[model samples]
Target chain A: MSNTDLEDDLRGTFDRAAASVPMATDLTGRATTDARRAQRRTWMISAAAAVAVASIAAATFGLSGGRSTPVQLPVAGGNAPASTSAVETEPSVETVSGTWRPVQMAGLKALSAERPEDPVLVFRPDGTWTGSDGCNGLQGTYNIGQRGEFTAKAGMQRLIGCDNVPHTGVLQSAKRIAVDASTLEFYGADGRELARYARAR
Target chain B: MEFEEYVSARGQDLVRLGFTVSGDYQRAEDLAQIALMQAFRSWRKVRKADDPHLYVRRILVNAYLSMTRRRSFTESPSAEIDPPHPVPDPATDIVNSDDLWRALAELSARERVVLVLRYYQDLDDRTIADMLGIKPSSVRSTASRALATLRKARQSHHVS
Candidate 1:
């Protein structure tokens, strides 16, 4: 066949394929929701950066003898006083360095990831984590306190709109974490079980 | 135009373009939504572009390319096209369309992308090259090779 014939065939194929797509349901709403989430995440990251900058400025000012008295900055969560000593004690905990797949979330066996894809979380030993929230990629920093008191700050993420995976929500609210050879579970601030995950083989 | 207005008017077309390029309906929707969401986030700059539609299309295409690259190398194109499509009737135009679809699937991503941008989107070689971040000569060569493969597939289908 001539190139013209091939080109016509190409156009026809695309037109038919495109026609097969049903009208997207509530695309505007979905996009708007995703945009809002992205904006919120961006604001959170900016606020964290600003706080870091302020801490640095405070440290620099104190070192330059600009103040007669030492400044006592509040620790994270602002519930405890900041440590003044240069040395710190290490928390005794096993590393949660592996990939885990959600088995249950918030008392619901059926997960948001069931429709499009399954969510997976990978925690590295270096206090960093990355995974897919079924659709969009997510990355964040995590810290495990002395008694498995877990805190996570979600970092930058792909702004792609997807089904609301409970994994991210569970992680953000997780105050305690437990892990074994085969399973991982997150607990809320009130000690309520939030989610459970199985180590991916 | 306002971002919402733009999405209302051209969203379906963008999704269609995405489907044509990705060959997956759900993924096409996601790509279109993501592109639209991104455009919404920076609607001012997007609206100021020479062609806002093309700008969004570029984002959609780039997302698809990046996604495929991140996928496991063992993945198969046939696996990605998992949704069951209707059997092609020999007497209807869909028979040729189905044959062409399979042929398109057999082509590499870059080759298929070039053909879709060139024939489906009616873009020129230079523009296609610019969007794909390849030399124009490479685009021409890839298109030529892909066309030859499609012709062969068509001839073989006719023979059978």
Candidate 2:
């Protein structure tokens, strides 16, 4: 038989077979739930790593006679103080590493308006950070200096641009980092708020 | 379009494509679920592409290929002995659709994938190549080889 005839025959057979397959009604719900669960799993792993790193830092500081300061721990369902000064007293490593989802971006509210999935930032204890601003994936190295000072080396990022989202500025200009309860803040060198995020569930 | 809207629009079509690739309804649903989940996680980037459906299709193809590879490795020995069944004569039943499907199932996974993308999905060689991450020339050669295998199977069945 000719090639065209064989191709036609296969197509006809496949069409007939596929017609009998039932449509799954709950696909959207299941996929959405699974995606959220996967995101949560990633957040949990990062949070766990943050906890481990915080423990080690605390132990080292205790052995070295570090200055004592009251650090506000993350409390479930508790409101973070509106004042940034109250939160940055003594930022622990636990406050530095973990998954954070962007909730607000100063002067970029339009970018956050329509997106249901927030951009995520994940800081690792190994001085590396990875994130996505709901568009491009970002990775870089970070350093925490004395007196709540933070600096991040500009790292490689994908160039895919999303509408209205200034992912580059938010990720690159992140000169200062602060954590208070579930709230995490990124600031520019000028001390202006670049972006704000909440601990991801 | 929003991620939920995209899912509502193309979810069923993805499932159908999965069915074509896997040749099983339940496996198709599982594969579609996995592909859609991945798409959802990266929807921000995926939706910005020239063809979001193509991205999802690539995910589906990759998942199917990986699953088949893993299954090939972990496949357990079959205990039941198969009874001899008569092969249908292609001379008499020239258009026997069941024989064509059985023959398709007998092809290698890659061959079946090429044939399904070419014949069933009605995709061009370039598109199939992009989906499978292969060269267009490789797509043509794979499809040609798959067709030859199917033809040989049909002819052998007729002889028996």
Candidate 3:
């Protein structure tokens, strides 16, 4: 069909489909509990939100627990392709060198439970990080600079959303252990350190 | 605004919108009622927002998206409609109310939402996107695609 024809058809279709479905009985009455008992005065928007809000509230319970922790909404981040980067001999920390350990940080376990779909990150030496956050599973660059401490300033981070500050307590604890103690400690989100030890000799 | 008066004026329009979006009157009514309650609870703050109506719309839109969780959100048929006016010319009618309901049913939940917001509520892309917590671009794209589907449905109805 021609463009003009398509446009006309589109408008026609919108009007018919939109208008035909029966409007809710006493919609403003039903949609909202809002009503003014005052004496006669005109011009008010009644039960305005009812027809407009649908399924969003039905699933509110699922979101309530998740809201306790900042769960990143999904954006389709994925695992990095296996390459020389995956299985190469580089002095830098890129490939997974050490054995995997339980990320005893309950901050994430708590966060992940809320949004199992969000992505998580585990930093590696050779400029990369990986893991499934609450939303997506992903691995990306880890630029750690020793001399400039730019990477220190830039910092390691996972991308779950927060109002402002997030993972504030845990990351600080983890960084202090990484730098001063030359040690690693596993901690639950409750702030109980689960395990502690010096770097593997 | 006093809650009672508010209900009388905008109640019908809200119901129309709910029916338009969900294609089920019962579900629409429940949704509308819940939206109103929530609005009432927050009306003090809502009244202060840049467009209080827009704020309420956001709440309603959010409520609709969360419908699956509500025990009352069933897929029953529409409640009967006694049109405000008597029947008019048939040729001009083209598709009757029942025909329109079926077409709306065929749309995905998201499509139904976009179309309802676009025409029924008379909201623009920016407003719709804000309501859905999606980008404005997604609103435009969804509306265009949904309208295309509606047109196809209408055409098929005509041909048949």
Candidate 4:
């Protein structure tokens, strides 16, 4: 057969092959799985970022715990022009290394990784910390009391990559945790925490 | 358009083209999935182009080439394939299907891809070159070599 004819036969052969192959249920199973995969990827990327930002703030200023820099942070969708992220930003605390205790957070399943689970929580001596919350990595300010409650204040995260979960919810929850954990009694800003610890250990 | 909708519309055609190019059903599926995900990530930008589908095809060919290079010296899974056109046992119609599958799997990844794009996707050499980010000369040379190889394979199968 001529080459053109051979190409035609090859095409025919492939068509027949596709027809013979057992097809996945297009209505539910295969389609749903792909969607799930997409959502998971999105969530994974976002959570990693949020935790990074929240942790960075905690690491940078919370180590000092003396006083954080008070700066104007740009409010979202507030008729701001140019440099929204830079617009109304809060000031940071002075950099200092202290005996920072690592907050142990459990239940982070490392997806899309072969080995070595990512940091769910990390503590630096300068009283700084960073880690992911399952899906996102956060960076922010943290304050630990000699008593047990802690606060993660002034946090930000970047949302990128493919993940298969609701990003908005994850980010909001992380922020709320930081804001609420402001007391030794484990009470957040509104004073509501089920756990408390001393700063030393 | 929604990602799901786009996938559904182009899914079958993509698989077919992928199979033709990759010369293996399993590898074709992988190419399609990767291409689909990559396209989704940049859908906002790619979907606006004159031919979003072309974007995916380019990614497939480029991706397939990279994959082949990564495993250059290794034996491919399709090494044991039987040519598709001739059924050894017409008594079992399944043999027809198996032969066809074997034929596709036997083609080299490059030849398979060029043929698939040329015949199944109905893309000209220039377009295929653009999609794959290769010089048109390379596409022409590859296509010529692939056509000759495919013809020889088909003839040998027919004689045997």
Best by TM-score: 1
- How do the residues A55-92 of candidate 4 rate in per-residue lDDT, one tens digit apiece? 54445446657325432222233343122122222212
Which pairs in model 1 have colliding backbones? Answer: none
How many residue-pair clashes does candidate 2 contain? 0
C-alpha DockQ for predicted model 4: 0.20
What is candidate 1's lDDT per residue for A1-201, written digit by digit as tens?
Answer: 899899898888877787877788777888889988976875465445444433544465457665434333322344432333232233213457788888766534346445455679888764568888777888876667655666666866766666646566667766566666776766554444556777795
lDDT of each: 0.71, 0.68, 0.47, 0.49
Candidate number of the best DockQ? 1
Cα displacement (angstroms), candidate 3, residue A74, comes to 37
Query: Candidate 1: deviation at residue B102, Å?
Result: 1.3
Residue B83 of model 3 has an lDDT of 43
Kindly list the per-residue Cα lDDT of model 2 for residues B75-97, writing each as its tens digit.
22211112223654533333466
True contacts kept of 4: 0.18
Ranking of all predicted structures according to TM-score, beginning with the best and ending with the worst: 1, 2, 4, 3
Candidate 2 Cα misplacement greater than 4 A, ranges: A54-201, B71-95
Q: Report the poorest 10 consecutive residues by lDDT, candidate 2 chain A.
A: A67-76
Give candidate 1 misplaced runs (Cα > 4 Å).
Answer: A65-201, B72-92
DockQ of each: 0.46, 0.37, 0.21, 0.20
The sequence of per-residue lDDT tens digits that candidate 4 reaches over residues B40-101 is 65566558878888877776787787687773545346522344435455534345334444
- Which pairs clash (backbone N, Cα, C closer than 3 Å) in model 2? none
Candidate 1 lDDT over B1-160, as tens digits, reads 9888888889998888778877877778888998888777667767988999888888788777866776453323421222344664443566777788888888887888888899888999998887877899999999999999999999999999
**Could you tell which candidate, 2 or 3, scores higher by DockQ?**
2
Superior candidate under TM-score, 2 versus 3: 2
Off by over 4 Å in 3: A1-201, B69-74, B78-89, B96-100, B158-160
